[model samples]
Target: MDPGSKLPLSPHIQIYRLPLTALLSVVHRATGVALALGAVLLVWILALAANSAEAYGQLYPHLASWYGQIFLLGLIFSLYLHFCNGIRHLFWDIGMGFDLEIVHRTAKFAIFAAIVLTVATWAIAANLEL
Candidate 1:
């Protein structure tokens, strides 16, 4: 190796294409933050539920709005994704899902399963007569 030779630096994002795994990694962290915030929101809902009917009534209207619905939907999606990916991590802890092909396939499957579960949960919630 020539001590005076200049090493070529890697191309920047402007010249690079992000891969699925890279995107998923970023989404995982973002969803984790979302889930933490959702947990606080859930605690607020529980507090409302435990209070008197009049107090609960006051909070219910806000939650019935379209914006609230969207936030709830996003929380549900984040919860499912986090849960599914957590289980996948458990498998990895046991020394599985390390193979390149298996890792990609399982990650894809987990994402799909999370989406399906989130949709199913929302559908059931929508159908509830409450």
Candidate 2:
């Protein structure tokens, strides 16, 4: 390495904008992490179930509050996103859908589907709860 030679800079995140495929890949990983956290919440709910109905009854309303419901809805969105992305990956494993057009199109579809499914699921659940 010569001191006079400048090092080449790859477009770092601060400099380079990520494309839809790259952004969705990052979001997929983030959703995986969020799903783990959601799993922990489920475990807590399970513990309550195992302990006593009285225990869950005391906690249900708080879990039904605005923030809790928002978190649950976010969890649902993550589940759908992750599921869809996993299917995308399976297609990749089969050596399919690597074209830029397909990648971007599927990425957009996954995001849209996740939102739609989450909202639809919550709407149905709310109706049933009533």
* Candidate closest to the true structure, highest TM-score: 2
Encode model 1's per-residue lDDT on 16-129: one tens digit a residue: 777666667777889999988888988888898898788888988777899988878888988898888888889989998888888788889889999999999988988895
Worst 10 residues of 2 by lDDT: 4-13
List TM-scores for all candidates, in order. Answer: 0.84, 0.89
Report the Cα lDDT for candidate 2.
Answer: 0.89
lDDT of 2 by residue, 1-130 (tens): 7878788767776989999888889988999999998889889999998999999898899879999888787889899999888899999999999998998998888888888888888899999978
| C-alpha lDDT (0 to 100) for residue 53 of candidate 1 | 82
lDDT agreement with native, every candidate: 0.84, 0.89
Query: How many clashes does each candidate structure show, in the order listed?
Result: 0, 0
